[model samples]
Target: MYNIQGYFEVESVNEATALLAAAPHLLVIAGGTDVLIKMHHGQIEKAELLSIRKIKSLQGVVKLEDGTILIGSLTTFTQIANDPVIKENIPVLAEAALTMGGPQIRNVATIGGNICNGATSADSASTLFALDARLKLQSNQGERVVPIQEFYLGPGKVDLKPGELLTQIIISPENYRGYGGHYIKFSMRKAMDIATLGVAVICKVKQGNILEDVRIGLGVAGPTPLRCPEAEAFARGKTISPETIAEIGKLAVKATQARTSWRASKEYREHLVEELTQRALKAAIVKAGGEAIA
Candidate 1:
């Protein structure tokens, strides 16, 4: 039912990169959840498919000597949700992974493919953004590490260069250590739906009630998943309270460039941004051992 020019399965990063470098037209496929759908709709035709499912090295979670976590690109959402390391440390990513489609989709949907697809509505994007994750990209030429924020170029586009493949997601210890985080996905339905808006908040609390530092990531807010530096700046060193939380929400809205779409209007999305920002921050604050603000 689909037009395919060629199909190849690769078993290693080197093999995949070689193939990519030689055949620049080849489309990399991992879980094939998004790519196949596009193929079915004729959005993609006569495509040469390169499957990376057999690549063993690209499929697990590892903690490095430096205490940074390296998540292989092929890791499934189900794996992420159940991984002990993810739950004990960067649980916001696990929570985001769980909110993705149903169990079936989660079983095969990969973290790497999700990121490479460059969808702003991707449940994992905001969490990774809040975590300040980095991407390791490999090519036949060499490898390069890019900040996650720099990976996205626009809706449905990423900065992946020709012959380059995303290999690992890196999370430094400082990003997750002593931080409590929460992710909120606002959508039309609770299951099997893309986010109309997603907000992720992670913060460090000190002296029981003061916010030592904070990071906020918003999805479907603009051309890409965005971090609210202004809101984060406002929260740092502040005591958690209703007033502080309210102002943080307002500043979060200032970072968005929401636009009218079939899913929601710009004004409506902006409203959700402000409301959800406060809610997620409150939840994160509590998780960080701070008193709940009313």
Candidate 2:
């Protein structure tokens, strides 16, 4: 049972924002994925609870007039994984969603909760980062959209202001138009294990030989989900040869500052970053119907 405190079940976005503004120590709960666990362990203290799970506004995926995809904040991982539009366009995200915990967890865990938790090993994070997703945050004052890459301040920390609630995630159409990508989560076990390292690669292929554009998103290899700009730049306009792929892998490792953790050693994490980066890139190439130069 949660500690005795005030509770608010907000049914609309405005009500949620108003509740947040009034309760300085209020904690928002959607799907209760991360928040309940913390509360159970007594990790959360002296705070009123605000439940946004019933808010209908934050519950589905929609395509905008301009072809951008808008995913409501409360959409569950299961909803994301099985959504036809998501699978058809940005399947890398769906694949990532499938690898998060088990069916039960995915069924209740909202994508908003996952992103808001801001874990370094957040499953959906790397894929969304590679897709160059943006988040819409709102408060009583107003709303603003922020690039996902800038939303993280550090491990277990985010840029969300006290009364601000993340409302939606937006993905530009250009990212999913002519691109293929994959998310590879390396964990001790296939299910219910946090990623030791995760790599997401989205690439636009040209003529089955060259890469037109590339984005590499890394997880559990740094303080936040990281986009490898240097490696992306290096891969662009380069023939996807064995040597080029190898060099890009090295660059990805160089871009990360992986540390020794209970799950793996620093050296081992670096090795995974190098090997997985190459594998993800190669897989993306194949998915894009391009052949890596041998």
Candidate 3:
């Protein structure tokens, strides 16, 4: 286990920010599921620890009057998966949250930790990307909102500034209303395994069974969770059919830049990207109250 030079439990966001500003070397911990694991593995060196778990403001789900859903940064996965507002609005996000580890891990794993981890295989990232979520970053100076899609700089890197804490995740009402979404995770095992490939799709249907709008988010197939814009554009306004879906799958493979890893070969991962994309799209369409043509 790594040595802890200092440990402070802050009860408010301002207190957390103050501590972070004063001690820039201090590591932030929300649920401590991820950070504690790293510390135990010796992946993290000795440093001060600032625990934000006691910050009351950073928990639960709020539906703002402006039609935006504000999720506290410290909200646990279990909370997200079971929150009525989240279940009714962004069902795909709830579905994704449930797949992230088992019940016990979900009870303690915070959404902020998952996003801040910046792993390509993060289950929530792709769905959050598809939902067009935004993050509220708070510092002693003030707060600023950044689109979740632009939050990742690279693997294990994020856009968070020094002393800035991720305070909330904002999901605009427009994304979830009248839209159907699906999140699919391909892994070797059914539970407690990182995704080999993750696919998220959100679709809106127009008259004539055409896809009015579609968004695709992919995980574990690139340096960061990716939005397959080309496939989305191609699928938009197109009649839902096997042929159209197949073509979109092909586009997904072309859009992804995957590398061979111990879990999967490049070619195999590419195939999964194609297959999962098609399956997710079809499921999303069906969810949108459209009939999928096999």
- Candidate that would win on TM-score: 1
Model 3 misplaced stretches (Cα beyond 4 Å): none
Q: Pick by lDDT: which candidate is best?
A: 1
TM-score of each: 0.99, 0.97, 0.98
lDDT of each: 0.95, 0.92, 0.91
Q: Which digits, one per residue and each the tens of the lDDT, describe model 3 over residues 207-246?
A: 7488888889999999899899899889888988899999
lDDT of 2: 0.92
Stretches off by above 4 angstroms in model 1 are: none
Candidate 3: how many backbone clashes?
0
Candidate 1, residue 206: Cα displacement in angstroms equals 0.3
TM-score of 3: 0.98
Cα error, candidate 2, residue 131 (Å):
0.9
Q: Per-residue error at 176 for model 3, in Å?
A: 1.5
lDDT of 3 at 143: 92
